[model samples]
Target chain A: MFRTILLLILLVALSYGFWLSPDFKEISAGVAIFLFGMFSLEEGFKSFSGGTLERVLQKSTDKTYKSIGFGILSTTIMQSSSLVSVLTISFLGAGLIGLGQGIGIIFGANIGTTTGAWLVAGLGLKVNIASYAMPMLVFGVILIFQKQKSIKGIGYILAGLGFLFLGIAYMKSGFEAFKASIDLASFAVVGLKGLFIFTGIGIFATVVMQSSHATLVLIITALSSGQISYENALALAIGANIGTTIAAIIGAMGSNIVGKQLAGAHLIFNGITGLIAISSISYLMMGVDYISIYLGIADDDYSLKLALFHTIFNLIGVIVMIPFISKMVVFLEYILKDKVTSNRGFDSAKYLNDSVLELSSTAISSILKETKHLYDNVFEIIAHGINTKRQNIISDKSIDETIKDKYSKEKVDIDEFYNHKIKGIYGEIIEFSTKAQSTTISNEDIERLYSLKLACRGMVEAVKDTKHLQKNLIKYSNSTNRHIQKEYNLIRQGIAELLRSIYIISRTKEEDVVLLLLSKSKVNMEKYDILSNGTLDRLIRADSISDEMATSLMNDSSYAYDISKNLISTAEVIFGDVENLGMAMSKEDIDLILDKKDN
Target chain B: MGIKKFIKRAKEILGLEDEKKESKKKSLKRLLKKLIKRKREICTMLKDKKSKELQEELDIVSLQIKKGKKILHELYKSN
Candidate 1:
């Protein structure tokens, strides 16, 4: 029904223009060139600022207001909201930013994108911008050929300018052609029919181009050429706002739960705003006229009015919705409910959604979430390793029997299938963290990333140590020597204490609790030393302990001490500062015991 | 002599009429004794042993021992 109405208006307008204006062909050609130039400019800016922009977006802080500010600033700088939305989806998928933060950034992004509309409107009203556009294109082409990095950057900026002008030129030319046609002119002047027709035109154009800035330029050109009135242009601007939200929704479809919620919020924000603007058409037209008269661009040029209406609609939307942001968030959550069977594995690349990278705020927050998941997974694995006792560390005989008797051989292919399944998840997290860090993140974000990376490394090291301890325990169990058994038991207790301390420190977030645990770990280390030294002295006096057993016992004691020391240091790094490392080591001072042995 | 003869005749009647049954049963019992001798050996190498030409032979022996144990337990229950 909407399409049928829109087509009738275009047909009437085309017929009227055919009988009216002269030099319409020249004008159409100019508008085409202008539009081409604008597209080139937008593309060039994207190429020049892609990686650094993505990095900053991935490291967004938790503050909601800060994310909103970042969204606006970044979109304004990049001149595209689609990019911002895609980046948001990526971050949400990676679990870097919460749904609320993503929504705020998207909202800010919408406002930032209007800067382009205003720029186009201002340029359209003035003396020919095409005159400047040609030179930019020429210089841009030359710079594109240059090999130097700085030259390339300049080339990109020039190309962008050239494209911007070209887009404007094309828009101007198209409107002129339409204006000259008598049929088009008469159709455009058909009052209420014309208003709905142009509004539909604006929505279709913006949706097709995936850019509100481009659509606004076309509307300004049509109005300036006298093909449409100020009132119809305002209606079109309203429709354009609704069309812009489509890009965000498309970007969120491939993302996870949080991303879908953000996309839903974007739609609601734009939809409500569009509804209000459309319903108050007369008021909007009055405001646009007032701005046009004040700006002295009211004469045939409707560009000023277009720019004013765009700004007014956006500003009103922000003001009306700002207080109800929490409600909007809840509504979005209700719409995009969490999937029941979603995979929980960490994926860093998902945070780098190609679309959201254009919008830096959402991208940064997504990256932060991915890093947190990586840290948590590594911590969980380490805790599991520490808790697994020696008896259970050996492959359980009952499980093996069950596998052999009941399950198929294919199901028990341990090396080919089981190991890969477990390690693949870890590999993905590491890969993502590496990629995220490679981007130009802020110092604070870098600190957080570094902390997570280090925590993962510490956990991995702890697991390796535990495996080594398990191997030694198996060896001792096999050897029937009573002395070896006794030594193994003693070392096992010390190692168990060390593992407990590491697990406690890793799980804790509170500084005071971590400090208390570190002190207790130090006390355990002191007891370990006293027991080890006493056992060594007795062996030396009796000459009963074998050289191999003594060596093994010594290695075990040293490992215990090293592990304890590493755990304490890890805790200190996490909690920040510790008083002393050797506070309670006087009981079996290893150096004094060694000196007595030498004597 | 009388009880032993009766048991041997019963074993022959229940599909153990082959000449290798007595030697297979003896070797199977020895393997079981070795396995139960220590926990470490049972944990590490119960399913990890290997042989080149005699690998199939070892498998057959192991299976035979498992079957013999099951049959002996059934016989004891009946008695």
Candidate 2:
């Protein structure tokens, strides 16, 4: 609704401008074309981020200075701070990077954006760039029609540059024509009053345009053409700095608390930077003059001086605020505490949110992390349900000896356990997956999501199977009949052992070792089957156990096998890196393992 | 006629006389035929498949057909 209102107002303003002057229409069209180029440029950069960008970002953000360098380099190359900020927020939302790391990136982006001002001041005004734009557009349009991804990406990059140059050319001519009719510099206020007013105009224009680069270009072009004074342009630059935080704030709106906190940091940093610039304008102007004189800049070279002033003040802000990063993180955390859901006993999702749906990678990441959280809880519940400690199952102890110990009947309540631990997260994952599938996700990603949901279901089913097996397990653990008790103990031992192996596999980084261990477990699974081993038949034939006891043992053993199977299957999907192993325990491989065991 | 008799009569009408002469081979051939037919049906259904359920079913049936064909090939070699 807010966007719609803003659009309507913009439409009204543009319509009125078109009626007043044809020159205004040309300028407005130039701005529109320029913004479209920004969009295309962002798209072109995004096409290359399949894994390399994410990997580079993850590896580079380990330290404060490193993160800042990464931020500067990425924004300089991408040439769009808004894109950088959104990517940083999405990474923060997915818990891929720390809040401090995110803030460092934002600060570096501030300095990185000064490069754009230099480019426009140093070259854009002096060069006849439109002559270069024609061939670029022609070649770009030709390449855009090709089928490959990289070709299309390069096409967008070339076209975006072409449009940017053309837009600048058009805007320059239109502004020159407008100046002939009426000088905009005549309306410029002087001193402190003029500073605040122009700063406000700068903020409004950046917020409306959502690009500080665009605003800087406009200011530089106007300053060069003598339509705006250098001092007022300085104030406008400060406002543009503050206004760019709106993109970060808007990006964080659909994110979790961490994303919002990073946005808060952005606003505070930019807000403080703008205030400092406005207050220390006179002092900074003296410094700029000294630097300008030292660099041999002429008195009439306001555009170059403005670019230097922009760089210096941003450097000052980073220097001033760098020491207080830890404190800022603490303050933001204290203010933006995670909201606890009232009366809910279990923890809910911290990362999954509707805003992340804008990017497929972030959405998949958030869900993957949430599913990990679910699995952690499920692992604990499974341990407890089996009447063994979680540590013991994952430890080096023999499970055959471990199941000999008796557990209290009071602990394993499947219904209450399901309600508290598994059901809510399971439902949320299924719902989230269904919603994700509706988006324009790739088929491979959709299949991955489906497999994840199935893994969750497998976990829940394993718990249910354990619930059925638990009664017989506890009952026969203390049974007087040695044969019946021994059979039940074998069943318990088998499941506990399977859980231990899976637990071990889950913790190990060696994929080859894990794959071999999983295949061996499938081979060993057949050994525990009482029917295949003839244990039940041998005991009944000898009349060592009652028929009722034998029947109970048979049924309980099947449940045990099922619980292990489902749990192993779930583990394979969730943690085992099944794809690298070429499908989880194919039947042929299992048969081969069986044959080896037999041999 | 009863359903079993009707099936037998249909087989006879379809000129499956050689199948009756060797019951073991006949059963193996019938299974192979059934599996191949199911595979063809799955392939057709999968062309414009919309649901994951259908995809999963197709995968299972395809696996089953592959295994069945392997077994049928082994039986032919033995004969």
Candidate 3:
């Protein structure tokens, strides 16, 4: 409701301003074009983020300094701090980076955004930049029409740069023209009162624009044209810094708790930085003048001076806040805690979110993580449904001993467990996967996603199979018939062994060990089917068990076989090498290895 | 060189020709090396205290090593 009212007010104001002055219309159009350019630029950059950018982000954000450096470097290259913030939140949601690391990146991005001021005041105002805009737009549009992903990405980038240059030229001319008609400098207030008012204006403009970079560019252009006072521009720059956190806060809205914590950190950091800047404005301006003189910027060059001031103050903010990131993390955790949903209510997907859906690699990474989360629940559910404890399976105990450790005397409520733990997440993974498939990802990623979907299906199937096998497992494990009891015990042993193997495979870093365990589990899975091995036939022929016992044993054995097969295949899909693209081993490969061994 | 031969050579240079086959061969070689090492370790363990599980593992590793080697050889031969 508030957003709608604001939008209507903005439209009325814009229309009224356009009627009052054509120059106002031009400046507004320039800002519009500039914002559109920023959007295009971010879109262009995101196209390549499918892999290379993702890899760099993962490798670079291991430490605080490195995370900050990554934040600065990526924002500088993409020229959009908002994009970096969104990506950081996505990474947090996917469990890719920690809160401290995220804080570092946000700090770096603050410093990074100052480079835009330097670019605008130094080159954009000086050069005949509109001349460059023409060819770039032409080439960019041409490339955008191409079929290849990279080409289209390049197209958007080129067109984005072109539009930005064109927008700047329009804004500069519009301001210069508006100066002749009505002196905006006359409207400028002075001293602390002026500082507070302009700072408020800066925050409001940036909040509405949603890009501090855009708001900063506007302040710089207006300052260069003498339409705004130098002190007011400085206040606006400080306000823009504070307003930028609004982007992070908005990005955090749909993200997980970690993302929200990082956004809170961004807000608190920037707010404190803004307060420090406003309180010490005189000292900062003197320092800026001293540095500007040392750097040979003229006394009248308020625009360049503003850029220097922007960089220095943000650097000070980062320096001041870096030491407190940990404490801030604890503070944010205190105030805005994650809702404790795990203990009560239907368990939902943790990693799947709108932010991660921005990049293909992130989307896939989060989906894979969510699948593992689902599998964790599956492991516990299947373990307990079989009357075997999860702790025993994960322990370094022998399968014989592990299978003997019962989860409970009574059968576990599999239906209730499934509804509580598995169903909601399974539905979400499928829905998110379908949504992700429509994005600009490669067919290979889509195939991998399909395989992940299959893995989820298999996990669900395994749980259902456990439910079917549970009744008989409980009944026969305690039966007086020794043969039936022994067979049921063997079924438990086979499942326990497979579960142990999968757990090992998921944890170990060694590819060789993973392969060996997967292969070993494949071999062991064959042992679950007594019907195939003729053990069932011998038991029947020897009259060791009754016909009813034999039938029950046969059906339960089939379910055991299915449960083992599904879980093994799920492990292979989720934990397997990327080179395989989730391609499971064929039965022929297993049989060939087995047949040669038998020979 | 002719266009086809030039293109083929370029693909080879780029490591794009029969990419799946090359990757499979590489995977097989890696698996075989590991399998051979595991088999040796199993054999060494068997000498001190023989166990049915260890024996079965030795057989499985040996069979995999042999099969991987054969497949890898076929991949090379086809190339």
Candidate 4:
């Protein structure tokens, strides 16, 4: 409600300003266009993330230096530190990268943003950029209409650059006309008082723009137009750096705990760097001038000097804060503890955070990971439901011993386990998958997503089947009739063997190994089907078991068969695609293998 | 020549006529190579162990190699 009122007030103020001065309206339009260009730029960069960007992000960032380097390179190429920070947060929320690595990337992004200032100061101010914007816009719009993803990505980039150039040109012209009417330079205060006031203004401007790079570009254009003094511009740069953390903070609001910790790290890092730059302002100016002279910049070139100062101070900030990253991670983790860790039981989706929903690749990766997490829970429930201990199954113990070692003396509440462990996470996976597929993801990713959703359903079905099989499993295993007891025990051993094989498959990365184990499990499953082989009929005809026992065995065996089939199918979708290798053989092949088996 | 005809001719000459088929053929060849190596290993292991598991593995590997080779053949034949 308050936001509505504030928005209404802002609209009225904008209207008033537009009415009072055409120059004000023009400048406002320039800022709006610039912000829109940034959005387009982010979108353009995101289009490429389905391939090299996402792959590089997952493969790189093993070391702190590599993480920082990735941050700098990505931001410099993309020309937006805000985009880099948001990606880092998404990566963290997806559990793709660690907190220390995320902080390094944020640090590198600060330095990377300095390249934007250099681009604007060194080239944007001198060139007639608006002329270039026209042809770029034409070509960009044409490519944007193309069906190919790469071409569309290129279109967005070119169009974004055009809009940015046009915005800068508009602002420059507006400032020039405004200078003739009113001397904005006369309003500049001196000493620390002016520093504090202008710094506050810079913070407010960047907070409104949500982009320090934009704010810096504005400062450079204003300075080049002789509308703002050099000292005040320096202070504004510091304020812009500090205020940019708000973007990371906002990005982290919907993300998981690691994302929040990274945001806190971003805030604290930028805050200290801002304070350092402000306190050492005179020394930084001297350093910038010395470097400027050495590099042959003119005495009148305050804008380049400002860019130099921005780069130098951020470099210094990274150097000074590098040692503190480990300490800061400890501090942030202490402060922003993951609530999921403290609350035990009733498992929720750990990797399905909103931040990862930004990209289809990240979304697919997270859901795939969350499905494995669901599989973990299903393994436990199925192991316990059949009265076999989970550890014994995963162990290298014999099947007879694994079946002999029961999970509990009392029957586990299968319904409660289903509700507590499986249902909530399964519902979340479905909801998140639907949300993901609704986005502008490609058809291929959508197909992969559909498969992941099916895997989740299969896992849940397996657990429900285990629930149905549990009652008779408990009753018949302890019966006086040795024949019925032996059959029930064999059912337990069958499931135990399937669970162990799946556990091994889930852990191994070798496709051949996965294929071999899957084949073995299928053969074993067929071997244990007593009803299909007439073992149950043999027992009844020979008067070895009663009629009631036969009925129970028939029903229980079917349930057990379903349980094995569902879990095996689930494992195929989850663990079978080892590096996209065909780990799961076709049903025709499996049947052929079983038929040729020399028993 | 017209632009579309020129492009289509260029793609055929460059062996980029159909990207999916090209990649599938490449991956199938790679898998077939691995399966052949695996079949050889299983054959050796069977000579040493005389185990049922080794024999089953040899059969599966041989079948997979046959399947991959057939797919690769069809991919070329259609082209």
Candidate 5:
């Protein structure tokens, strides 16, 4: 609400300024165009952010210095610290990179942002970049309308650079024209009072713009045109540094706990940096002056001096934070404690958070873990649903004897168990899978996600089939007729054995043996199904069982077969290795292979 | 009377009226027939594939099939 009110007020103020003076209008327009260019550039870069970026990010952030260098290099090339910050939060949330490494990248990003100030002050103010911008825009728009992603990405990059140049030209002229009408330099206070006031203005400008690089470029342009004093520019630079954390904070809002903690680190680092710069303002200005003299910069060249001052202060922040990184991480971990709720006998999703969606592998892994969780719960329910204890079924105890002994026990409400164990988690896995589909992921990962979803569906169907068979199972299990009672026991024993075999296969480490066992299990089910049909039909034909009993037995036998088949298929998805899963092997593929062998 | 007539007309247009019930039942019957046919084909294919794959384990399966055929013959004679 406060942000909305601030935005409304800013809009009204800008409108009033535009009406009063054309110069203010041009400056505001320049800022808008530059911010738009930033957004376009971020979009363009995202096109090439496939597995390569994630691989590079994972491999590069192993050590502190390498992570910092990565932050500096990427931020310099991308020219958007906000993008780097968001990626850091995402990586941290996905557990791909540690918290301390994330902090290091953010630190390097702050120092790297000074490159924008240097570019604007040194080249943009010197050359008529608008001339270059015109041709780039024409070609960029042409490429933007092309079909390919890479082409469109290039188009956005060209157009973004063009807009950036054009915006800089507008701001330079706007400040130049404003010098004739009004003297903002007259408003600049002297001493520490001027430092505090200008710093406040700098922070407000950056918070409103959401980009400190934009704020810095604006400060440099205004300072170059003599609209703002050199001392005031330095102070505004400090404010801009501190205010950029708002973007990181906003980006982390929808992310997981680690993201929020990293955002906290960003604020703390920037605040401390700003305080140090402000307290020793004179000393930093002296250092900047000394550097300016050494580099042969003119005393009146406040724009270059301001850029130097920006770099020095950010460097100071990084240097100060270096000694206490481990301490900082511990403090952040202490402050942002993970929320622990009662287990309640149902497993909540461990890795399926919004943050994991940023990376495809992370998203895929999270889905796999959550599916395994659902399978575990389903394991217990399916065992108990068949009127056999899971321990007895999986143990060396004969499944036939176990069912024969315990068939008279009270039946488990398969429907109730489905609701309690499978329904909520199944919904979450599907929801998470559907949500992950929208993210930029690899084709292989998408296939994995879809396959996992189907596995969950198969498990649910198996449970529903069990529920259907439960009614007749209870009725015939205690029947006075010997033939019908034995046949029902066969149905229960068949399903229990299949479940037990699958449970064992899922835990085994030997892939080849697991595959062979799974195939044999498939054959075993077929054999049992054939036997059940024959035995039930023969009992009815002998006039040993009634027609109703025979019909129910036939239907229950089919249900048992289906339940076992679906459970085995689900196990293959959960337990099979990527190489042997043969998810890529379709009927058409098998036929083609067989044709080749035949040839 | 006017509102009732309008609602009835709307239901007819939307295919929610009872007059559309016969066609709905026919379509449902057609779907069930298609499903049942598919199920039988799948069962036949499954039986053949498993018999072939379970070569060493086919002894028990053959006995089961032989028994089922004998009972099926008895059922047909009784009918």
Candidate 6:
């Protein structure tokens, strides 16, 4: 009820300013200052709230409506929808939140964003808010320089004041420019063409500024400047609401199904509301005008009407859409059907939001997720390499054709990209994770990140070994020497066993399952050792195997053992105590042990 | 004088002395011994891989061997 009355008051003030205000620039400036203040206040509040906001987000795992409510409350406090959306994506990627839950959160984010718009609209009517901005700025600077945590609150207060005035100043300038135009009133009609034009203007403006709040401030400025009527301003406000969905859409494009779905729900909510608002523009204008007259505000006061329209439209949209969330989800699923199966490949960019970096714990979690994806990619490449080798041995024509025609090129591309491109990305994540670790991250998060980094490094080393083995196998296959072929086959068998152990360890989450696989890998190492010793003994006896063949076999054996050891060590890091795992040994040790055995 | 110099060069290239032969054999044995030590190293590495230790270690013998192989290839190419 209070919200409705507040909406009505803002609408009347807006209408009066548009119709009767002699100083259009001042009115617009006032609105801008209010918006800037609201934005700064929200940012200040977010820093003050810190982990509490994240904790609130973590508790939002209930149904969609609850999640949306949580999203609204959190984003409202944080004051940035971009931060909210990026955080939501990170959470979704981490499997902390479901698709439906994320959708609700995003929906809530849209609503939360309107708090800034409303604050601007309400405060735009005031004549003397700018007087307070300077003192706030001064106090904020003092707080910033105080070097004490308690004093930072003063800085936030000052920043909020400064931003409010700055916002007002720009808004005033825009309105003055608009009002000074000779034919401003000629553009005030609120028909279908007007609606489309205003909507397009809103979306384009929001996209340009990358902030819906900025676009809303501009709309208010134009309304208060007498450049647009209340009806046209309302149309533009509705458009701004829809335009805000663009950020989430761009965010979802490169992300997974859950991200796309969450983004889709945001679009569906806004798109539907946009359609409804456009259709009911005449009625909504009548409603705005009727309320304005009741409050004794003239039709020319466009700023107040625009703010009221913005708030009422979103509130009504939420009320209407809240009941049909499941339907909306289904609709969004249909609309973004292409995202369901198309493997656009994983994007870790969602975790790269600068806002999240300010919060160390969330940033650490994001880094860990990216590192996990990197490890998965490495495992995929190695598995595919093994598959290629197996297909070669069986001489499967279809397999050979697939490898040569399709996967061979892909393998090279992946190798080049992984080795050259992703190494830096992974390294940056590690570096960031390390820095973030010094901040306020939990012990468990730190351990997870550390373990994940080890796993990624191991996988990278394993891929390098696989690449070398691939080159050696190619050479051995082409040589056509029977003795070399036998040695190659033996070495390949050992490598196959090693890969199998890695595959098993990766697939199972149970510690015992990994431990069992590690034991098997150990047994395989012993077999490899016996094979190495036999080959060396044959070489010493001057058997049929050439010296080159003996050397190649030894190299291959050593390589396979090293790769297997790296993989098993990675699994142990994930499952066992990090301290119990002995330090890594060198390749020369394998040869030395074999020589000692021979003696 | 030219013939003597040529003969000396040939002897050096061929490693003709008994002492040189013994030393070559000893070096070969040492290389083989180092290569054989890889068995234990392989086992240890496999253990670490299974356990998944995260620390970065430099100057590792296997890594050195891998490095040595690259240097040897470069020398072979230049020759």
**Which candidate achieves the best TM-score against the true structure?**
4
Residue A594 of model 5 has an lDDT of: 35
Tens-place lDDT per residue, model 3, A1-599, is 98799899999999999999999999888899899899989988887776667778889989999999998998888899888987887787777887888889999998998999999999999998999999999988987887667667878999999999998888889999999999999999999999999999998899988889989989999999999999999999999888878866876777777778988988998999999999999999999999998999999999999999999999999999999988987788799886765557678898887777778888999999999999999999998987888999999888888877787888888999999999999999999999999887987789889989999999999999999999999999989999999999999988888888889989988766787788778877774579887999999999999999999999999999999999988988888662272223457756765665567
The whole-model lDDT of each prediction reads: 0.57, 0.77, 0.86, 0.84, 0.77, 0.61
Off by over 4 Å in 4: A339-345, A540-543, A578-583, B1-37, B68-79
Q: Is the docking of candidate 1 incorrect, acceptable, medium or high quality?
A: incorrect
**Which lDDT tens digits does candidate 5 get at residues A264-334?**
99999999999999999999999999999999878888888888899899999999988888899999999
Q: Report the C-alpha lDDT of model 2 over B14-59, residue by residue, as the tens digit.
A: 4343332355455545545654675577678778676654544444
How does model 5 score on DockQ? 0.01
TM-score of each: 0.60, 0.83, 0.91, 0.92, 0.72, 0.50
Ranking by lDDT: 3, 4, 5, 2, 6, 1
Clashes in predicted model 1: 60
Candidate 2, which segments miss by more than 4 Å at Cα?
A: A1-6, A138-150, A293-298, A395-401, A581-585, B1-79
- The residue-by-residue lDDT of candidate 4 on A452-510, one tens digit each, is 88888888888888888888888989989899999999899888888998999989866
Pick out the ten consecutive residues of candidate 6 chain A with the lowest summed lDDT. A577-586
Question: What's candidate 3's DockQ score?
Answer: 0.25
Would you give me the overall lDDT of model 5?
Answer: 0.77
Model 1, range A1-599, lDDT digits (tens) per residue?
Answer: 87588678866765665445444544544544545554555555544333455455656636766677778887787676766666666566555567777877887887887777777777545668778878987888887676543345557668777767766776676666655544344545345676677667777767766677667777777777777666777777877878777755655666666667877788889998887787777787787677777877655556666777787888788778877878887787776676554445322233433333333333344444443344344333332333323332223343223222312211122222213333544455466556666664444446655655564455445445544544455466345877776666555445545445545566665433344455445545554563454876687468766777677666656654655555554445443322221112233433333343346
Model 4 chain B: weakest 10-residue lDDT segment is B8-17
Query: For residue A538, what is the lDDT in candidate 3?
Result: 97
lDDT score at residue A110, model 2, on the 0-100 scale: 87
List runs of model 5 lying over 4 Å from the truth.
Answer: A92-101, A250-256, A286-301, A326-330, A337-369, A383-413, A432-449, A466-599, B1-79
The candidate that wins on lDDT is: 3
Chain A vs. native, model 1, TM-score: 0.66
Comparing 5 and 6 by lDDT, which wins?
5
